[model samples]
Target chain A: MLPEENVREYYMIRDIRDTPKALDAVVKSLDGISEVAASARKFRKIFFIGCGSSYYAVLFGSWPLMKNGSVLAFALPSSELILHFSDAVNSDSLVVGVSRSGRTAETLKALEICRGKGAYTVGFTIEGGSEITGIVDEPVVLDIGEEKSIIMTKSFTAFSLSTAMFSSILSERISGEKQTLIDECKAIPSLARSLLSYEDKIAATSKRLLSENIERFIFLGSGPSYPIALEGALKVKETSYVATEGLHLLEFRHGPMATIGERLTLVISCFLGENTVHLKNFVSEFAGKGADIILISNSIDLGESTLKLPPEYSGECKALLSIIPMQILAYYYAVGKGRDPDKPRNLSRYIQRF
Target chain B: MLPEENVREYYMIRDIRDTPKALDAVVKSLDGISEVAASARKFRKIFFIGCGSSYYAVLFGSWPLMKNGSVLAFALPSSELILHFSDAVNSDSLVVGVSRSGRTAETLKALEICRGKGAYTVGFTIEGGSEITGIVDEPVVLDIGEEKSIIMTKSFTAFSLSTAMFSSILSERISGEKQTLIDECKAIPSLARSLLSYEDKIAATSKRLLSENIERFIFLGSGPSYPIALEGALKVKETSYVATEGLHLLEFRHGPMATIGERLTLVISCFLGENTVHLKNFVSEFAGKGADIILISNSIDLGESTLKLPPEYSGECKALLSIIPMQILAYYYAVGKGRDPDKPRNLSRYIQRF
Candidate 1:
């Protein structure tokens, strides 16, 4: 076990440890989320906007809205929302901004622009009375999801879980579907807590596997896990200063698989889904090519390197919990590389520049 | 100039050389594209689907539908369409599949799934009577855009142009927007022909820049050129076996800029857009960090490294023509690394597997 000083030095680990509590708090605020989802139904289009890890949070958050809700929904980076998609936002549109501090300049500017176009705006942040709340019409704050570290950990998972719950509620209301989302969300905190119990195992495995001349990492996932993969890759890239790329599971085989070799390690998020067969096939193909693979999946064993979670979890819960082991891996890999996980090179906690 | 045998050895160059003619043929098929656009109006949603270079083509193609045409549009890989977006497809959707070869199994499967959901399906390929045409309800073939090389070149540009024209025509019908798209498209073949004149220069520049231990590339763009950036990165990754990542212009500064160093070269696609100022600021920031930057834009000279295109070109024409120099760069970069451009390592002409 690591010393208390060393563990405290890795402040992101503390935030990671808080994820289960964050999930529980978010689940408790389901009524508030449902209120936001009710207003979301009035909009013709829904746009999710944020920056960096928060942008990926939007990618994970927008899925349920697009798949189950009636409105056409999209997730774009805050800068992209302002620059490339201005025409798509109109009076009938809804812009949802996701940021931990609620002070990302681009996200604030994007909300301002959307509101200027007469679009209803919503803000999701950990701060109750932040800058975003003043600019947007509605604000849903998850105070327990707040982070003490520069790198996002609990907030990303918590905000994404909240948005997933929001979209699922909207789905139930719009389509009269069974309210399966609420029951599943009720189980997520415990599931996430159970997942955190594997932290030491993940850290040990990461050190054992990555100690041998690994230079690049490829993180792959499909469906909701796709954005989780992107976030995982970014966490590694930001923390350890390693070259990492995240892609859709099947999209990797199309072209990026060419770069797979001995120096590469594949981190796959193979949640329980219809595409599990294809993911296994891809893993076997990569394994034949002498690449090391670390699979984070539910119950299904893809060999000895897999970190299996509890089986039969709902889709929403699986999406939120799949990134836990990856976050642990990134943390340990940073320590292995002898870098400060608190301050990633050449990055700021908030992008203030216009 | 290269020797005859060497030139003949590069089959991809032959395809690149045929781009102008391909553009002309696609321009001639504008009536067919208009017909497809007419049918597209019946759908509430338009989804563009493909894989790899063809998937980038879909990203390029979907822009016009989302921005100019009066419908909700999205571009996704064919695999994503089949796997994650099943709920988004219904009787009120139109799925457009783009493939250079009509034999790509995923595209056909995506169309099959879309049709199974009662969505109208349209196919675009170089093969007139191929499997995609049989699978989809409507098929439009640009026969002249067919390629003999493993990598796609002309077809990507041609199909994107046809789709841009398709969306423009749809916009014209729905909103009575002026027919500037038609006049702009008429200039594309000539512009593409003129772009080929810079092939030798691009090769020379690529060789010089890459000669000094460059291993990774970052391609950045905004608006229509964003997909161009992705396609450019894929081309280099596929052909030269070099590590390349493409990202939106503003999105890069958010985090990935932390990865910038001496070994990384920034390939920027800057067309005439409102975000020009912000892009220039980003370039300045990267330049101050001592990283190499190569800019591809229309008559906008940020520095000596900038490759200038013909001035006063419309957005659609600029988007189609911007990838010319990048394609040439990838081709010669492959040749410089002594890899066969036609037979890139760990890749195939089509992805037939699930």
Candidate 2:
């Protein structure tokens, strides 16, 4: 048996490193994803639902369908869906519930409510025989192994990839044309492997942040990358108990920019979309305000602080890759702060109570 | 000429105190709101778009339509709509743009995009001659006077009330029955005045929080009240430059509960809905963790920390009233922190740049 200290030291980082394998496992399960997509294509509206990290994953996954504009796709928190939005579900709607543990009370209940409303329900999870698999009409269970740590690392990536694949396949089925997003997704597993090689640099950055006495973090992203920013902030908050907030790049300027100071670190997920110039200008303007900047992008390196991803990935694929550096940062930040990433206070693997 | 100190002293509190008058003005403009609702009822989908505080207002305003479940109603950040979700807009859609100043660049651009896509567009704003009024097909200009302070208080309430009224009228048009929400809203001006009478109590609570050296705040709400939580958090950040976050009440238990500690204040916007028990249990559990609890509710008061609201209002109307205490709290918190709420750093009356 592994010693307690050894298990604690390795659990979170091991899950972080296993993300590439998780992506590969999801790639291998494309046939299962396609089956869900086939069922999804018949619906006029799709609701992607989950809780916590899974909610962020579904948000990332729903981007392709949202951008395609052929059908209405809404990403909602499961509790919100169950409590307020269940009435929106009907026979013509498809509800996709994602839960890493497949036992999130709100998500399972949300799926039940949607089913009661006569909507097509699909469950995405790593657990094959969990409560979600039984409740959902169709369950796309990923083969990715479980994480020893409570903090989601590989499972988040795998669930996000699976949902993105589902969206891509569904988009293809609707348009009767092949999607390049599927092809772009195929490159992620290898790209994610390369991202993990920057652990030392990420650790050094974390050390530098600790040395600077950074009091809080603000993550910013645009379009498909917005969910990544949210998940990044959640990751840091859960792992290190940091005071962090995530916002749409432009939304930050609206009010949150008031919190900008030398003690604040801005982690931006940058995409080479129409708003690239605006994002660049925003970074420079905030940098001038004494805030530390860390740009995670597939294109346009702003400065030495930028964490560059493989330039080939774009759109939703780049959004998927953007979370890798954030995961690594959260890990090292927790370690630097002498906190156990494997056991965050006041949280569990899945919320059982409402 | 008035002294600088006098201007600084009155600007924010004066705006907060003017909320009742703004509600009265919006109530008097029911005819204009009805005209916009008449146009909105013809659409199958409704998109409520805004930026910052206006964004939160639109969210609160979109609740009645969202709850009715006849038409698809989405509340989105204007920047997100312009950069990503614009494709969802079509000829059968109604896009309502809300901006206090009617000159927020993103909201104006989003309205233009919706118009170009052949969708009907309506502008809701305080400024009659602003750019949005010129760009949108219809403008429901509120007669609520300009805010003396840069931080939105009266304008937020006025905009939220106008939108809520629009949603209620649209719902009544679709259902061919009178909506109780509108009748409930008619009582808001007086209810708001009564709420303002609790200013001394709110100020004492703010003083207690400051004395305790509360490092940060997390505001929580559910259903329609979620936007109020977001707006409350934003108001504090904008006014006091504090590290704050807002989450759906249940979403807080997911990952953010990890941040619960002695210096943390959980400001919950509680409602007497299906999840009332859940909200009560959540507050007690967190209180056990040594976190300060501030419950804002209409029907329930768990302890001394609970800020009671008038019990008659329910649903959307109750949600609108929930923000008054938060606005007052934000104002006093800023003043207690030795910061001028009227002169928040790195902010302007309206964001002109993208």
Candidate 3:
């Protein structure tokens, strides 16, 4: 299927194939930590730092690192890193700094603090010799999918994709899954190519999704899907400029669901926790309330026009895939409204200086 | 001070004083959480639960509890109690449930799960004889103001005020400051009344704030002020529907400073650790960037309007006090826009079903 034919999972597939080199470069470059890998796993914990979309990637990425047997992994925004929290980073701590542009002031400051605290430091940045490069024990330059327009598209996905592969590598090193990880990661790019062939169809589906004059957007998922829900809402909020909210499927019933109606656009992430049957029921409940549903999952039970991501990616991968459609959905939604898709009205990609 | 006062800090003086029996009457008429209260004090860790505004109240209130030695505490939404994080709680855990109506479905459900797990539970509500009472070992009800508005005016403050007092009470138990707790709490109503007496002035000040037509809104405070910044943003988000954001003064330069203009409205909380001089410099930095400044604290040294609350609170109390002006700011902004303060167009105080 092509982007125009399926119109559901196209961007997701394209995103997978489109950002491979960036992902591969990051993996190969950041593999060493001595001059850059730091004091031989010297930290008690690895704190991944970023904000907004980057913060989200760190969150999802933290899961795999947790499986690496380092449960102390935490994702925090660079802003929070500098503001209230202390370097509570001991000499043994490792701070993995992440930024697409490599210029976000807080990330630079955080790297400075990590080094100042005599802790291990490493960074993933798009630009080499940027301020971030000078502050690291090892700096991995990943200039993947650099975007000229402000709102992050290719860069965000590439960064997250690279983090995923990195997590797999870490998981392999610590959890004894080396062979499987190597095999899987090697297959990812080709798999991504297969997915991209459906871009035309996903694009068509996205156009249909934007046809409704939706004033309210509610996105739902569970487990790892939780972060995807947040990202989905963020994409819509920053790009489409809509009143969007993201919450776990069941959590919506807690209080936010009271605002649901025909005017609302409800997006559900299907590749969720082990037991998504209840989530399916939760989606049905929304349907009962006259809300439209957009399902993105590896499973087909999510109803018609579902974006069936390849089976190789489930669980957290399902969550990763969820990001693609929402990105395209927002991109298409923005252009349809005669608004610029590249540079949203009140937002910037780098958030420089302020 | 009257509602129209330009003075800041409206403690629940008049309202609480008008209903002296609120503490005892409400406590006795409802149910007492004597058993849970007694047992909860012995937990290794405690978790507070609620939804939306109520959920945020627990987050803001938890810091004092943390400082007092319940260092492993977490404030979670009731809806999340059993879904994604049921593993976090068990028979050994202590749980506090907070809700304005006392009957929030998710809160009740969460309480049921807690009791089912044999975890000790305390239920705080504005009314009695509901699911919360049925599920909790002890239920504390304070029906002080029957908040009629859907947007939750008096109820939000009442919850924050009562929770602060409760935390102070618990803090006293931990640090043997019971007498001080009672004395301090007893003094709040008068402080609130005195502040309320200046209501007319605040309303006038708020009128000017709304008229400023500031292009951006930035709130600053340290420590507990971080949560006040969150609450302030939540209020503004729900009310005037503006793109308002809050950050600690320390992190003000992260990225938000780039968009500063005279049209920017900078609300600075000046109580304890206010960093007023730094804040003035901050405002000057923004003014240099052409951003306007609005000051709110126990005191303000220069420029813009000063929301001067009497220095009767610190730590969490400062947070409790700091919220007053922002609430007024949101309320007046809503009123100025001719939007109903009680009922915003696309929102609900609670979402009863999925």
Candidate 4:
């Protein structure tokens, strides 16, 4: 067992260690819940809504499904589901409301609206028998230890699996490939443990990064990796209490790249959408302007890049997994800076009223 | 005429006094000609590619047409259009490559792809026969001015009107909203001019903001206003040299909102939308978190609430008129920081790469 600080401050480290057991439980539970919807005639569209980390999880999770099918899926901030875009509620829409607590106000309001509108609502959360189960047409509750913290970790992981499983099942049914994505998910914990072995390196890198004078953090990705950059930027800022941003890499040059302040830190997730030559040229331009470049890739083109992410986590998993290291980097930097990694300065968990 | 520093530092500020009648012919007369589009009807999509300021203008200018018609319009940060997502090129598409100067690498490469794919192309640039016309369709050469010290002043304004006109004409026949929108675009400049007249108040606010420890800027809106917030944030950052970000007011709370540092200058634009309540709540949350919240509303509320906007600048002018203050704020802030408002810190008018 680890100390409380070790346990809380480094949840990803802890999660990578305990993933297998958690994955086993999450898989069976997701299967059971999804079965409820399996009997339905059809789902007109897929809508994923959640708050905080779970909300961030949806950014990447829903992408595969969207790319695969014509299913119109919207991932709204849990609050917005109730506040606006509400007329969208209907029996034809399948609402997937995610909440680690199963008790966040905005998400609960959304679930109730779902019930009122007679929509087929699916709920994924840390604990069951709360409002999520009460409102959802079929609720899958896993008693992950995520319910204990204000900052989400295991819940985000759990949320990703749910997104993957749902999309994989839909994809499986559509393509008839029948490739066992669920089985692949089972290997994630073990694979993650291998990935976590590099934790010390990432932490050390974070320390070194702290020594530098990066005024802004720019995380850039393309294709489905785009939203992952958004989440990575968000998580780091929330945890590290730093000024950070994310954008599509090449977009940097046209205008916003000017802000690659002399002390700019560029984080790249090298995937295969854009031309390699163009990326190299842009990277060189920043290098010419004195920017520190950090590449996260499965390829070795960029020397000594930070995270060596698998080119393909096979499906949506890559998108979800790609964000972890950046999140950890943020946490370590926050911890190193003696700021509360959980409660960042001058911000709140939810902005309820204007 | 405005002082040399103001116009030289920022074009948004440069145009405040309005384009001088003395420079109109100089800005409009093109010395050379280029037209590669032999046929027009077979083209399926009209793709506009530019970077930064030029691209932001594209967002605002091409919007009404995109929302109203089926002509299928898309925008790329000239870099992205060239480096990535450039595979769709073919002789069947009309690619309008835009720039203040006919030389950005990405725009140029995109044009090359258009030509290679045998697609029709057009160039909307301040300088003619520079590098870009070599690859475009009908290079509609329009020179905005010699006022160019690299920062785009006359060019962007001209680009906005030109691009809007082009897209609107293509779309109006389909949506039947062309005349109304065009009339609205015409009202925008005058409305914007009136807003610019409030330079005193705007500058005062800018000077006061200079005192705050503001490290981040967040812009929020939904529906049509969502993209406007992006444009607004870009303007502020480009002109003011401020580290600004944009989010759907509601999405902020999901996770990113957690990073709203103590020094947030929150700009909330209330465009009529389904997310109005969510927008209101987001503003309140920022206020609660000790953020300096400024509500930009055309709909006047009671005292101390909003800086009442001039009446809707006629029908179609509402959205364009609403964004003028943001441009002004960006300009003034840039001046307050003693940076070149026209040629922001490290930006270029064109990006020409392989």
Q: State the C-alpha lDDT per candidate.
A: 0.80, 0.85, 0.60, 0.62
**Candidate number with the higher TM-score (2 or 3):** 2
Per-residue CA lDDT of candidate 1, range B224-253, in tens?
Answer: 888999989888888876767777787776
Q: Give a tens-digit lDDT track for model 3, residues A207-270.
A: 6766755645778876567667777777666655555656657655543454454366778887
iRMS of each prediction in angstroms? 2.2, 1.8, 6.3, 4.6
**Shift in Å, residue A215, candidate 2:** 2.5
TM-scores, all candidates, are 0.95, 0.95, 0.72, 0.78
Ranking by lDDT: 2, 1, 4, 3
lDDT of 2 by residue, B1-354 (tens): 124334245598888888999999999999878876665538877899999999999999988887776667888899888777777789988999998888898898899999999999999988989898899999989998889888889999999988999999888887677889888889989888888888878887898899989868999888888999999999998888878988888888889989886267889888645556666776777777777789888766767788877666555577778788999899888887888888889899998977
Q: Model 3 chain A, poorest ten-residue lDDT window?
A: A5-14
| DockQ (CA atoms), all models | 0.55, 0.67, 0.15, 0.30
Q: What is candidate 4's lDDT per residue for A16-43, written digit by digit as tens?
A: 3454456557766765756854744466
* Model 4 error, position A66 (Å): 4.6
> lDDT tens string, model 1, A1-354?
356436545788889999998888998998888888786547677788999888988888777776662567788889877877887789988888998888899999999999999999999999878899899998999968458778888998988888778767766766677756668778888888888888878877777756786757888887788899999988887887667777778887777767765267889888746566565776788777776889887745767788876666546447767888888888888887777888877778888877
| Residue A166 local lDDT, model 1 | 75
lDDT (tens digit, per residue) of candidate 2 on A128-159: 89999999899988998988899998999888
Q: On residues B201-285, what C-alpha lDDT tens digit does candidate 3 reach at each position?
A: 6567667766766434667666566667766766765656554555556445533443443255777775544434444555556
